[model samples]
Structures are given as C-alpha cells and as structure tokens.
Target: MSHPHLHQPRCLAGIVIYRPEFEALRGLVVSLSGDVATVAIYANSPISGEQQQALRKAASPAKLVILRPGLNRGLGAAYNALHQLAQADGNAFLLLLDQDSAPRPGMAGALMATYRRLAERGERPAAIGPQPVDLAGEKMQLPAAARQNGEKPLRASFVISSGSLIHLDAMAAIGGFRTDYFIDAIDIEWCLRAGAAGYSIWVDPTVPMPHRLGQGVIRLPLGLLLTDQPPRRLYTYVRNQLAMLRLQHVPVRHKAKFLLSLPVRLAVHLVHHRFSADCTVALVNGLRDGVLVRLGPPDRALIPFWRQGWRSRATTPRNTAAVPAALRQS
Candidate 1:
C-alpha cells in the first residue's frame, strides 16, 4: 500500500488505555512516531506520574497529549473526548486505537490513502479502517462485501474501533459516539448511524493490523473458532447488541443476523464458562435489560455477583455504576 501524500490533512491518533502492558503500549506509541502529527493517550484508568512521563517519552518526536479521566469512562466516552480534542486542535482526521492492537508500520498511511482516494472520487467516507488480523492466527470471518478482490476499499456496514481513521468533519455531522452504550458495540452503532446519514464506511484489506478480540479463541468443531470473553464482557455484548436492534439507524438485516445467532452465542458462552452461576445470571440480566431498554454502564445490581465470582482473577475491577434513576424506577 502507498503512503498518503504529504498534502493530505493532518491526522491525530488517539489510543484508549486501560490497565495496559507498558511494553506493548510503548511499542504502539513508538510505531506511530512519524505517521501522525500528535498522539493522544486517553487513560480510562488512572496513571501514575512516572507512568505518564514514560508514555510521553514513548511518543518521542511526535507531540503527545494525555487525557487522564482517572476512572473507567468506557470506550465510547474516551473516543468522544478524543474527537473533541482533535476538533479543538484543528485536525482533519482522528485515528482510534485500543492498547491491544499493534498496527503495522504503514497501516495508518494506507488507511489515509484509501480515505483520500474515496474523497477524490466524490465519496463521503466517514471512516476507513484496516483489516484486523488475529495475532494468534485465528481466521476472523469477514462480511461478504469485504471478501471481494483487489486493493479497492470495500464498503462495510461497520468496522472495529481500533485501527480506524475517522474523518472529523463527517464525525461532526454524524454526532459523537454513544456514551450511553458505553464500551461494547460503540463502533457498530456509530458506523451504522453514519451509513444512515449517507456517509460510507470502508475497510482497506491490504493494511492488516495485529489485533486481539476478547480473551482468546475457542476452537470448535469444523474449524470454527469463537472469541472467548469473560462473563462481564458477555453481559455487555448481549445488552449492547440488543440495544442496537432498537435503533432506527441500525440496518434491519444486521438486526436479524444478531437475533438468529443470539441463542448459539449464549449457549457457547454458557458451555465455555461451564454454566457457572455468574455466567447464567449475566446472560439472563443482559437479556432482560436489553429488552427493557435499560442502557448505560453495567447494571449495578449485577456487580457484586461478578465481584464474588471473578474479581480476584482480574487485574482491574469491572467498572460498574447504577443505571439512570428513571430506568431503575421503571
């Protein structure tokens, strides 16, 4: 893939960090040194003064800005904050990254090139993203449109947040990310809304970024591999997916696909977690809240259950908060 021409608009890269592995975080910052004008490290978790200094040093020649919320504000909130920062700084594009992703050298440039090419052809591309290749060599299934041949950017319904280069102007027109839905499915919700608003989403398959989805891959019969996630993740995933189904902007086919697969997904999660009490409760409550349209951070009622079941096994607490008063009363 070719590098974006120097004449292209400036790009700002925003990386959302939780409790990250320092080495990986440093590597990611170093990799983007010459590619982006500035690197914004948004700390969803608190960062020590020493760690902040270390992060700044990793950004090297590129300007570095730290957005320390000092608490877990969810992925959508972080992205929204990054978008505001980019707009204030007069950047034309915002590149989103998660700490788990390690983009290849020219990945950002390749995405930029695709965005520019699309723009020149009178296409309004809201965002352009690279294909996410699993680090463990698991084959992630792609949409039918994305499987087409050649280097041309393929139209996609949605792309993952990590490794996506978003056009700031388009984002302003589409509105900010949905902080209500919080973390899971934020990217899908935004991308679907963009399409509904007449902006296109593209994926440049030529640019592959090493990304990990969930905890790991669970090998199944007939070569199928399901992403293995914790029970809390399962709860958010189900709730958010169901929330999207209620949105007018989300395509009907997408909703139908999810509905069809919901049972199998729940069964898989149950078996994978050995039908543990916490896992069962998470799935049931997620379904109930989703149907009731109770959306926001994880439900507060479920937090202690998870804490007792698996909190000690995790590095960071699964951030939880009470639902809105209105929703709770309902």
Candidate 2:
C-alpha cells in the first residue's frame, strides 16, 4: 500500500453495513480506495454473493476485506471489530464511517495534518473527527456553541463515529466502544471514557464530511435540529442518554444539563407532528428501560414502527457517489 501522505498508508478505513444499497456501498469503497490503504467492510446483515463481488470489484487498487459477522451486531460491535483488526494489522489509526457518510476528497490528509499539528502542540488527541456537513448542503445552523468558533481544530465533547480518525493505542487504552450500547451514544461513551483517562477528542474544521444526521433536519430559530425519529430509534436515543447517566466516566455537569433538557426534548416529541402515538409509547418504555439499565434490542412489540426513514437518505441510488465532484473541489 502506497500513498502520498505519510498516514494514508498507515490508516485503515472501516464501514459498517446494514441494508445499504449496493451502489452506495461501492461508491464508498471506490472513494476510500483513492487514499486509504485498506477498506474493511463489516457486513452486519446478509448480502447476496453477487453484490459482494461488485463491492470487491469497485474497490479497485485498494485492498478490501469483507467481514461478515453473520448477524446484525449493531454499530458498536462492528466498530470494535474494526478497531481490533486495525490494531492487529499494525495500523496507527482507524477511520470509521457509517454507510451513509461520504468522505470528502483529501479528507484523510487534512485530518492527518491536524493530528500531527495537535501532537506538536502537546495536545494528544485520542480521536479526531471532521466537521460533518449535511449532504444537502444546508448551512449547518447549529448553535454557535455547538458549532464552536475558531479556524483551528477545536476540542469536542465527542465526535460522531462517522469520519472519526481514532488512534489505535488510544482506543486500546480506554477500552473499545461499548458493545452493549448497540448503537446510539457509543461514540460519546467511548470519548467520555477517553477523557476520563486524560485523553482528548478534537474536531478539525478544515475537513468536512458529508453526513445525513437523522431522518431529516429542520431549521428553526434555535438552530438546525434533527427531526423526530420513528419510534424505535427514539427509544434508543432516550435509552442511551439515560444509560450515559450511569457511567462513572461521564462528566457530572454534562449529565445535569442533559437531565434538565429531557423535558424540553420530550415536549418537542409530544408536540411535533412527525412523531406518532407510537413514539410517545416508545418514549415512556425507553425511560423505564433506561432506569432499569435494561439494554439490548428494543421490545419486540415496537418492531412494527421501525419500518420507514431509518436510512432512507443514504439508500437512495441518486446519492451514491461517496465523493462528489463538488466535494472534491471544495
């Protein structure tokens, strides 16, 4: 494996696949092939043999390995699997991406440059995440504090798993992603653990990755906010946030703030037209489950509500190109 940047050859890119369209997967593989030494695909669900072949063929000039866990192990397990693989393969860093996110051209180089600069400044970062821009090119109207200020890399509470460049040693030191978390808040939990151990997480402003945050985002006077998720996902979000409350590594003030905001968030769900009666039920159930520390798959009864809009944005064929021409130029 050879690349222009020093870290390109040493970094391994990993994507967790769950019902992603073949074209989208291929586009992502192809984009990663441009600079990544290896692209490890963790297939959490079954894909046809023909589709697997197409993925391999599309990842030309870059090594691709498909790791089929045989069942859906969820995001945290998939990420942990990739982290261990990267560590064993002697890669210095592992770049994690969700199936929906597409890396901007030259993102790896930009991230590595920031990593090196941070190290030079004596700030040892456990993970470095790029600012995520919505795929639709919506001006990220997040609150100034959430968006942060300054042109330089900024310290973050935690970065989303997608487009995060994590040091293998740092991952090992903090222990890997909590597999029990299943999906939501896994990144923040890992980051909090790292922070507790004196490691930091930073976000590079120069490198922006195209990501679709939720089912959709709505721009409001407050900021750009994610629309209410369908029932099951809402359950996970609530459950995971509550679970974080039980973690010793999580900062107390952060917990206090999140606790206070719970009512406002629930009130939005109650009033929002997007959320259904099922969402309210899931919310109540999730609160109970979170209090009891019961974690795993959601209640079987709620499965019916998981039907639409989970990954609708990413699964569309029209958006398959992981690195669009405009993104490359930017």
Candidate 3:
C-alpha cells in the first residue's frame, strides 16, 4: 500500500461528535490522529460544558463548535460544514466520522492513498469506507460482509459514512447531504446517487475502523428490532426515507415494495418490542407526513426545519444536552 501524501501532507477533516461519554471522544481523537496526515475536527456538543471542555482537551487538534438547539442539525449538516471548513483550511480529503467510530491505525492513510490511486487511474470513486469493526475490534456482522474480500466496490446502496473518505471534487459535483432527511439513510442516499451518476463507492475491508453499534438490537419473538434508536429517530427515519424515496423518484415497483414493506417492518417492531405510545405516534405521523408531502420526491426540504413552523422551534433536544449560544441560529 502506498501513502498518497507521504510528502505532500494534506489536511484530514474529521467530524468528532459530542455524545455522552468523555472517554469515548478521547479514544476517537487518539484513533484518528494515529492515521490521518493532519486532522481538524468540528466538535458537536451533546454533552455538558465540563465534558465538552474535557473533550476539547482530549481532541487536542479539534476546535469545538457550539451546536444550536431548535436546529439540532443532523450528521449530514455537520459533515457538510466540516467539508466547507476543510476547504477553507486547504484540505485535500474529508474524513467523516462519529464519536463512537474511530479509524484503525493506518486506515486513514490507506483510504487517502486509495483515493489518490483511483484519481490517477481516472476511476472516480465518490466515497470510500473502511470495513467497520465493533468496539472490541471485531468485525460487526454486516448483512453482506461474508462475500467481500479485502477492498471491494459495493454493488448495492450500502455505504457507512462513519469511516468513509470522501473526495472533495466529487462532493462538489453533487451537492452535500440532504439536510431535510435528518439522520438515517443520508449516506446511502448520497452513495446511491453517486453510483447512478457513474461513480463507485468502495469498501476496503482490510482498512478496519472500530464503531460502537449505537442502535441496540431488541430481542423479540417475531424478530430482533433495533430498539436503541429513539422515537425522534423513528420520526426522522420515516420522514427521511419518504423524503429520499420522493427525491430519487425511483421506479414505481421499487417504491411500492418499500411503502408496503416498511409498515410491516414497523408492525413487527410494534408487536415484538411492545411499542411505546411515542413509537406508535411516530409511526402514524411518519405515514401521514410521507403521504401528504406531495411536493414530489425531488423537493429537498430545508436543513433546519420546524415541525410546527416557528412555534415548535423552541423545543429542547430530548436526549442531548443544551448547546452554546454562539452556535445557535437566531
């Protein structure tokens, strides 16, 4: 394996998130620093002031940014901001990550190097993700990892943003993440779009990155459900999937299957996990919102949207901590 910028030295932009644990942030910083040529992070605050400051200290190279409430922008927005920041700072590549996920030693370098190789060969790889390993450094069972050996191109629409190396040029071609969709499926949406536009999304299985499975599995009679994600997550998942489906305007057959299948999947969860009122409410709201929003799938909703216009904007984040005033948008 060759180091693309062994001498060139390009800045690597990392998005170190501010989740609950201080030690987790510290570990991620250490992991990223080991492999990246140069790292600058846009730290998000979902923790206390004391914890945020401690995280800043741990992520020495990172400059913590205040995340505003009412906005609680999704990962896509954070990633897009990091890309813009990196561009301003003269970075060659963007390394997107969550606090729970950290690149293995040498993975970052290999990713960057691979991108350079593809560029040199005139093969435009939109994004490259390393095979994810669990916190214990074991490869988490992916739905289809058994078939992939070493670095391989993903034929379908599965790409992990947590450890992916994105090309600045390719990103410029297609505008950044769709902020409207909120959380789930944003990365897949981008990767799928890139693939449709003749760019390849690759996964270097050998370049291992450790990521904690944030969404825990719900063991149930029917089937295991990913119950760790919150009700709000459920809301975003519904809205985003609908938004993505609308935006892509995929084939009717595919759309029908998805529409039909999603409810069944949710029903399975509803029965198995003993669905909370919030979950059921989300299911109803999601269905209603998805059906009523006839603005065509092509309509990209604004990044910072309020469910009930200006009145609902004041609600606090249920799971995360309050954000600093500076980062908040008025």
Candidate 4:
C-alpha cells in the first residue's frame, strides 16, 4: 500500500472500511468521481478480488488506490488517516462515506456548488452536510429551520459524519478532529466548537444524501421497517448526548426536550426490539449517560465496531464516577 504525502488537495472522496461492499461502494464512487482514481483506506480487509474486478469494470474513468492501515483503527482514526491521503492526491473536495451510504442525484454536485458559493461569498461556515433522507428515498423527519442571512454562518444543532464535508481550512483553524473523543458525537462536537468560534454551518437542502436508518442487522429487510434498534447506537446516543447538554451554548430547550423525550424514545426502541437484553442494556445505558454526559462521545473503549469519521466529543465536568465500569473498560 502506498501512502501519499499529506500536503496535497483533497479532491478524493474516500470510502473507509476493512470489510466492504465494493460493488455497491465502487458503484457510488464511479458515479460521483467519474473516475476510480480514488482511494480506499482499509483498516483491516483489503478490497476483495470480486469487488476489485467489479470496481475495475465500473470504476473506469475513476481512479482507485487502496491504502492498508497497519491496524484496525476506529472510524474517526480511519478518517484522520484518510484525510491526509485525500489531501496528498491534490484533490480539492473531500467527501465522507460509510460502506452502505451513497449520494443521491444532486447530492455530490449540489454540495460542491454550495461550498464554492459559500466560499466565494467569504463564508467560513465550519462544516456542512447534505440534508439526509432515509432509505427508500424518503426524507427523515428533520427539525425545521428558518434560513439565516449573513456570514456568522448558521449554527447546526446536529450534523452527520457520513456525507459530511469539512473545509480543510476549518481543520487548520480548529486543529484536526478531537481524536481523544474516539467514539460518539464527534461531528456535533466539532461543529459546536466551530459555531462557538462564530463559524456558520449550513446543510445544503438541495443535496439529498440518503442514510440507512438504524433498524438493525435482523430487520434490515424491513427496508425502513422496525426490528431491533442497534444496541451499540443506543449506548453512544445516551452517553454522548448527555455530554453535549453540558455545553453551555446548546439551546436550553433542545436539551430539556431531549431529556424529557428519552423515555419515550427508549420505550419505542424497547417495543420494536422486544427489549432484548442488549436493547434493555442499551436503554439503561443511554438514559443514564445521556443525563450525566448529554449524549456526546463514549469512553474510547466502548466504541462499537463500525466505519466513517463524519461522526465524536463534548464539554462536561469530568464524571469518571458516572461512567459504567463495563463501558469504561470496553
């Protein structure tokens, strides 16, 4: 695996993983880059031969290179690792993707257009992402926001890492991702810092990036139907959200609503998932930690095995006492 030097442009759109759905993934890359002249940052598995052959066929016009990490680092680490690789290639735009996600029609182009337009207008709105729609091409229920004018940049309450685009300049200004976060709310925390620093964040509603809502491995066939809520997700959701609530700038109402809504969401998760031991554990963990930490990142060890950086962090007084010993060790 060749590691390119870091001081280059970020024109590459990277797919982060060890295991891959190269056919599905390379298909998206081919569609977006129009050339496989792209790179795969593999923390564990190399791109497979079948996937490779498919990539070769579909990835023509696009360029593809695979970089094998010395070990299986987590998603944030993979991205920080990929960040340099993308810049090394002299590409101007860096797109973040999960193995299962892809950009819809205008997503790639429109987001690029928005970024350029924002920059030309002299805006430094920290980070931006596509308005995510759920699978089956439906829009997720998103909070409504009135369009704001001017350069303070719009403050974003929530941002997803997958399909997220960050300005390299912003990274330079704020320093690279807070790697110490290692697990949850990474994107939200970073955006919060930028918002705090007066950088605006806006979602280009025109870009329709689709996300696979967490219904789980068993119910994936539901294709938006409910089954088991991913246990690990529940864990991170609880712990890290609490951490964010601690941040002073977060809207008081948002925090209060979230706190109040916890039980209802958990009940829904429990009913849908049958409150299996994992779900129950996750429910307990989520509420306990969300309150104490405000739903930010988890102890580095508890990170569920997964992919992508467009995801952890928070501002809270240390509560080494509040963390569950098991999660702390994981």
- Which candidate achieves the best lDDT against the true structure? 1
Off by over 4 Å in 2: 5-9, 139-147, 273-275, 300-330
Q: Candidate 2, residues 243-292: lDDT per residue as tens digits? A: 77877878998799789988878878767745676777788766766666
lDDT of 2 at 185: 80
Better model by lDDT: candidate 2 vs candidate 4: 2
Number of backbone collisions per candidate, in order? 0, 0, 2, 35
lDDT of 3 by residue, 1-330 (tens): 544444544646465465446676666666655455555444555556786566556644434343343334666666766676666667677888776776655667788877777678788888887877766676654434546655554333446788888888787776577554557667877776786677877776667777766466565555433535655666666665665566552445545756887866687656754876766766555554555542123222322233433222211111122222344421
Q: How well does candidate 4 match the true structure in TM-score terms?
A: 0.71
Instruction: At residue 176, give the lDDT of candidate 3.
Output: 78
The predictions' CA RMSDs to the true structure, in order, are: 7.3, 9.3, 7.3, 9.0
Relative to the true structure, how large is the alpha-carbon lDDT of every model? 0.78, 0.73, 0.60, 0.57
Give the Cα RMSD of candidate 3.
Answer: 7.3
Q: lDDT, candidate 4, residue 152?
A: 32
TM-score, candidate number 1? 0.87
Residue 234's lDDT in candidate 1: 80
Q: Which candidate tops TM-score?
A: 1
Which pairs clash (backbone N, Cα, C closer than 3 Å) in model 3? 246-297, 247-297
